[model samples]
Target: MAIKKKRQPKTLAAGRPPVFHPRPKSISRKSTKSLINQHHLLEKRKRQAIAKGDKAAETAIEAEIEELGGIERYQQASLQGQRHDRGGDSSKTLMEWFKPCFAEGQAAPDRPLRMLEVGALSTQNVCSKSGHFEIERIDLNSQEEGILQQDFMARPLPRDDTERFDVISLSLVLNFVPDPRERGNMLLRTTQFLCGPERHSSTWSLRDFFPSLFLVLPAPCVANSRYMDEDRLIAIMESLGYAKAASKTTHRLVYYLWRRESKCLGPESPFPKKEIRSGSSRNNFAVVLG
Candidate 1:
């Protein structure tokens, strides 16, 4: 028997098959475009944060971008182009501050002072003029032959006490750390390289830290009402038993020189600030300089 033919799907007026469009395909394109736009927005914000020396903001933005699956692009973009010198020979010029120590025979003149430059992009023979400093450079984005690639924050201390440095320079380094507690930890970590007490000790004597810490902070952040202002930083260092030796402000940067103070404080000095309380005790202890 001739049964009724099943109803056929309708075609276009021209008798051509209807074009099939997957809803997901269009939705995916729209979502991709949205993410790209968001990526761009985050990038712009990150740049602004860097320019403003707002490291916390930059870090937060980075975390957001990473969550959006754009970390690879961000990393590639960050590594592109020739690395430029952040702060010039000013650091070298400042080396003169320590000259008195050498001239007075407090420190050995024969052996060049061992200096560690953290976050270094280009080698600055700051100590070359006097042949007084033997510099070791390290950076997170090392692209050169001599600079050791490392995240100064996460890297472990030298196993041997003798391997520690006589001086450590953090030139625009702390600001790059995303967490305020981590930034404080970076300050505390400086003691690891400084000519100080044994690293293994749970507590450190204030007198043990003999190495000088040279720091360069962004001028805007130092002067403005930011989370990492100069005053706050000075307080943190003071809490750590570091007394300011000299401070100067360049057109765009703030230079600080600190020496470990001889003053002794009871175990309970200035307590750890809020940011540090939740972090590793090493960080908290470092901040307290106990």
Candidate 2:
């Protein structure tokens, strides 16, 4: 009889799991108690590592915590808690607040008022159906037809001052700028696109109110929202020669319509003679969008 073939055992390497794999859905569905305990344990270990001056251990622990989905889960829970804490309908749209401003300008429709919507690529139809205003849409990162792919912060104003719009909409744009100073720059740049401060000789009429800014921003205290508060925002606008025409709030956003003051009464007014500078280095109060 032939000798039996030698039997071989499977090697561990042959049975090894895949090196790269997607995280399991079970991790996301983990029980609240389990998630909390895991977070606490990681925090305790991190603290211990810090106390022992083990930088490598601390970094590794941090990475482990992140990989375990601890941080993301906590952030989601915190946001939910915040929403429940602030009891108001969070589903309201920016257009609702903008409608009143639009309605006010309807009385003088002899000329089609110009309106510029910055960051309009995402929300294309905001003014598409409106007969009261002609809209010019501009955006920084969209390839869709009709969207002007220009960065609002870097581009120069039109050669003809008349090309400036009567109203400009900044729906859900300001919060992107993490710096307060840069946010101010975004507002100042908007003024260049809007009708400038009324000359001393112009008579008061509905047209005086034609050019206003419809702005929407996240609530200052909202979870994971921008750091700037509504009070500070209004203050910044006022300092930049805008007076708040109207304001409203949903659960998470604060919307305001700011009109250019007939005259900037503040000592720091940029409209009197100073050019609104986009470079932060050139001017201390500069608001650069880039």
**CA lDDT scores, all candidates in order:** 0.60, 0.58
Clashes of 2: 1
Q: List the residue pairs that clash in candidate 2.
A: 185-287
TM-score for candidate 2? 0.53
By summed lDDT, which 10 consecutive residues of candidate 1 come out lowest? Answer: 279-288
lDDT of 1: 0.60
Clashes of 1: 1
Most accurate candidate by TM-score: 1
Alpha carbon lDDT at 137, candidate 2: 75
Q: After superposition, how far is residue 221 of candidate 1 from its true place, in Å?
A: 1.6
What tens-digit string does per-residue lDDT give for candidate 1 at 98-117? 65555543434334457788
